[model samples]
Target: MSKMDKKRMKYAAKPGLMAALDIGSSKIACLIAQPFEDGTIEVVGVGHQVSKGMRSGNIVDMTALELGVSATIEAAEQLAKENVRDVVLCTAGGAPESKLIAFDVAIAGHEIGDGDLRRALDPTWLYARQNEDRRIIQTLPVGFSINGTPVRDPRRLYGEKLGVNMHVITQASSAVRNLESCAARCQLDIESHVVAPYAAGLATLVEDEKNLGCICIDMGGGTTSIAVFKEGEVIYTAVIPLGGNHVTNDIARGLSTPVSHAERMKTLYGGCFVTGSDSHETIKVPLIGEDDSEENQVPRATLADIIRSRIDEIFEMIAQNIKDSGVDPNIGRVVLTGGASQLAGVRRCAADILARQVRRGRPAALRGLPEAATGPSFSAAVGLLHYALAERQQTSFTSLYSKEMPSSRFGRIGQWLRDNI
Candidate 1:
């Protein structure tokens, strides 16, 4: 009978196909899934392509990005034997920002209810409204308290005051618009936007890790993203502009090799730490703009040194970010995932630099996912599917002001109050 109830019914009536699209600087990936009656989804299609016209997760060339999106989606559709018009997009660009906001509402000694919860969250909505130049990606209720005492659920509790702590994540509006435009050009509609690191965390983190507190670091091609989870919710997030591509660039410059060759070399022979065998092994690096005969022979130790310096720098930056966030340094563990995390010794390097238990994380195994796509690089893409499922089931709070809300600011606020209050 209520607006939210009607919306739920509408979605329930049409549990159609769902898709997740992850557009990164190095690659664009698409996954198509079919939901079942038992509240589970199975992957039916998977596709990915080398990305172009993207830098640090933002679109640089609309046309080129459009082509990549179209191609990736088409490939997935072909595999799925189904056409999809809407996709949950996973984004790491747009200068994502995260902050915790606390708010309280006077309950007048009455039993708390949904109305009280909404009223307590009014400050968060107001905060979102004030930032016209940014779009909210997620607004999560991290904790609740009644009369200044921490409580899990304040509903039905007798309290004069109800308080809530919310974790809000936002991104620049221009970046969101560009991504939307690119999707539109590819004849695709964005059903929702999930932050990359958050998505990765959802897919790769175990329930214990989330509830007990842990950090999920997604090192992608152009950027590295961090998400801190506590009590089964994200408490903080940060993005660093350095990633695997930076290491590749370093290798290319240090070895005087082409970017493509440098990447291949890194993938095949690079490591963050030198080994005793490194000095004895040799790798032939082809000189840029030169014949194969002019290739330079270098000790594997030299290549490892180049990679070690950059990877160390990346981990150091991550360490500094965690410290700057003011989060507990002893927080349970650190899970590292992404393309860069696949490098040999990356886990060890991360442990050494972050001084925490570090493990390479990959997306949880899906029914139809290929083994090749089960690596850390696909965590964000798979996590988008998890986000879609959570949103559909209403198990997670996607946002206070969702896409289905009224268009006008005043109208939206009024409708929200009327619905909840």
Candidate 2:
């Protein structure tokens, strides 16, 4: 092989460094980590800042967005003392769509082998690429069957017919292109883009919850996304363009205050559930363009009431969306993650509306994380690290096809010659 090819292979084989860039509506965060021999990821660097030039998780201004991304990555690089050119990105934009496609083929009453399996999974990208405006992001083989009997691995199994069920996720092309454009302007290459909620599910859901069934809600600043996992695979995805920002807007309108003051109020005194003491407790709201002496005071109960109403509507819409997709919200437990899910009383509110036990999900603890950074807000970034590790271990098509061949180079050359010549 040429020197360049050898260099590329060496880089690909190394598993020491991994980076995840989480771009959300409210904030942009970058994490750099290294996977050790003990199956642990040690964080080396982190960078986070207020997000700009984004709305509803989509890039609205390319120049401004590129600057934000550049700044975030530069900060992370400074801490790590190492520069990175590529990153694993997390996306909640593009109105992600998920569906299941089934493939079946005849095996001629023979034992299933790699050839048969390949045929059964043939044309994988072709089918998903039928739509010109959509691009496939994830393609997972959820189940396999031999002779109409479901089996996890059909290799060496006897069967007349083999079938496979694949769960595919697709997103709008325009959204993806915009992200790529911004990355290009920032001098970064995107290695992969995983859906925001799907990544959160990977970081938080336990084995039992994944096998049985579960719902993951990722609440962000500009969008609220939902992901459903059954039998340890993602089966459905949905996104709503309303999130914490909407609640802040509602508070501003209801209290006749500035957006900044409303946000502070929501973070400090917001709760979906009311208390008896709220009646006597009061909060001072600063009006737009007004001095401190002109601030208005109102009962805490009124603020809670406004916040609760908006939160209730969000959960109600989430429940209805699940119903519309033909999945019962009560089928499994609900896992809540992301920055907005950290609000007080949000879990209880979700439980009441979705009719399922709700638990707050946080990212797995890794070395070198500050107390302030280890929270649900970083779940997607953590999950991206996990995903990069798992994906690197998966078998490639070339290796699978050559599994039964002789190990020696000459023996492999003979086999290839016999097949081709």
Candidate 3:
């Protein structure tokens, strides 16, 4: 059967709510959305809580992570007044790697159809499968060149050789298994897994920026990741094990304050650039366990200095990674997302360090998205919604296929326990 025919036969018209869960090092967030006929996702519910049991995107404490996940899901369900059995999850913990694989298949002057496309894609899947220790999460067709001519839709065209460029994103197997285990413990099924930076780029980037080439930097609590986009598809990604929490830690250590107080000071008085009055501006910092006292005062300029040093270091690291990855020099713009991007003066710092145009990107406003949720921090969650919408509109040829896995007896035993218990 033709691929389109098979797709139609396999799935029926059962449109319903789409749930997206973003499990990050700093927070656990869930967004419940319903796609309309017009291709827009109306967010019906949103929930987020302070992250626990996860460190640097890895689950350090399973029970603690499960409790956080459950609480976040319950809040979202309460807001939506509906429950979800499955969710599209966003992950940053898996040491994700992106590769562009170029392959060609001989079409023998025949009309391009499902068979031709499938043949072209088979090798890409094979390459992903060869990496036994990795879990393939995203397989995106970057573009197609038919007999040296570029075309977006190659079906029905006649060519001797059809060449395809596919961008494959893979993550560590252990990270994925841990996330899946956490969801299973909560009685939730994972519909699909998306890389965090990829989702953020999808939610916030415009078509023009993507086509023209751009970099998306997602600064979470425990990790800062980058996604490079060219021709409207992600071509490269890298992550650093440092983020806003590190800066907070530095402040806590430097200023002899508590972590919680350091976070508060970072949010309120944090800036990469210092003004003349900063030296004279004294901010009251309360001790973690002590009451308000006169000795707990520090100059705001000192705080800015600490923040600027760390932020500058982050940008320098990002620039070096981009250079090392050999990202296209034509990528002249950098879009910064995630909670850390909200800090004052980050844009200018990134621009000066990365030597690119920098702008803070927030999730695109959609129906029922409150003003509070329309910030850079929520970009990944919102991008999950956008991914679902794009998936819904995809033709059979463009759909992402999950990697093949052998059914394990241990998996069956675990399933039986969950079902029976």
Candidate 4:
């Protein structure tokens, strides 16, 4: 039996409706999309709600988590005026672990093709076996080098042995359970879950940026995720326990204000850098126990200083992670995404602290999504659609072998088509 023959026999098409759920520390967002004719996706419905069960990207309470997910999914489903029955979850809020693992195979001098590639990947199934305290969530390919020559894809590469550079990301089993439990509470099913940072990278990054070198920093409310890419592959990824919400918390503690007020002030007036002008710029701050009209005057410079300090600290940590990941001058620039990346002067602050050119990346270049879905803050959500598309396209051709079929048949036919076209 030939590999191609087996693939044709076992292939199945995926359903059209794709539901994406992004559980960020700041919020729980759900999106339902349908792929369009132009290789783009359109959002049919969307749901978003502030997250409650998670803290710093980890689940703190399952009860609170259940309510949060319920509320968010309800709102999204209501807005779209549709009943959202299930979703494909986005994996961002967790430990954010990424590691490299590989497998080797002896080909017995047999020809290698797409089916062979699928067979080589069979070992990866071992990582799927989960136990207590752990869940394998992502299996991203870094590269495929056959006999020392790096190949973008080894589907048709004839080689004696196949070597794969794989990036595996995992998170706590408890966290996964909490999310699944919450989804169940909200009347939804978990079709699948993808790493949030990787999804965001797909939505915001271009082919060249990923192929050459680029770093993606998703600074949400509770955690900041960093992913490095080179040659269209993820080299490293990490998540920090700090984000915009932490800065807001710092301000609330320092100024003795409520979280709601602090968040309002941060969103409306917060800045990361200050000059002489900010010193004289007095902003009205609400007093905790005052009437509707009661407020106090505070220096904008003070607010900027507080924000800058925390943001700089985060960049320092990111630089350290980049160093640990072996990313140097080769990865020249950084792309900032997520909700917090929308804050004023964040890119400048990132550039100054990381000593790299930082740009606020939005999901601008994709097809079929509305402008509302194209912002840097919605990168992860938009990327989910892309992930679902890629997943649906994946096929296992390992058994594509027949006694009467020859590998040369496919090669000759492919060549003939290429020449004729």
- What lDDT would each prediction earn against the true structure? 0.81, 0.76, 0.79, 0.70
> Which residue runs does candidate 2 get wrong by more than 4 Å?
1-16, 109-119, 122-128, 328-330, 395-421
Best by lDDT: 1
Candidates' RMSD to native:
6.5, 8.2, 8.0, 10.8
Estimated TM-score per prediction?
A: 0.89, 0.86, 0.89, 0.84
Summarize candidate 3's per-residue lDDT along 148-232 as a digit string, tens digits: 8998778899999898887766677677778878888776778767889988998889989888898999999988999998878
- List model 2 lDDT by residue over 279-327, tens digit each: 7788988887778778888888888888889888999998999998876
Rank candidates, TM-score, best first: 1, 3, 2, 4
Per-residue C-alpha lDDT of model 1 across residues 245-276, encoded as one tens digit per residue = 99999999999999999999999888887777
Question: In model 1, how large is the Cα lDDT of residue 325?
Answer: 79
**Which window of ten consecutive residues has the lowest lDDT sum in model 3?**
412-421
Model 3 stretches astray by more than 4 angstroms? 1-15, 123-128, 287-291, 395-397, 400-421
Which candidate model has the greater TM-score, 2 or 3?
3
Candidate 2 vs. true structure, TM-score: 0.86
lDDT for each residue of candidate 4 in 1-421, tens digit (9 for 90 to 100): 5432233234232357677888887787777777765556767667677787678888787787777676666555554555555576775775757767666666656667766765665423434343445555555567777776777777755777777776666666566666766676666667556667777887888889988899999888888888888887777788888999998997787666677888888889898976776778987777776785877788898888888899999989988887786656568589999999988889998988788888888775554455666667788888777767665554212122211122111111111111111
Model 3: how far is 15 from its true place, Å? Answer: 5.6
Model 3: pairs clashing at backbone N, Cα or C within 3 Å: none
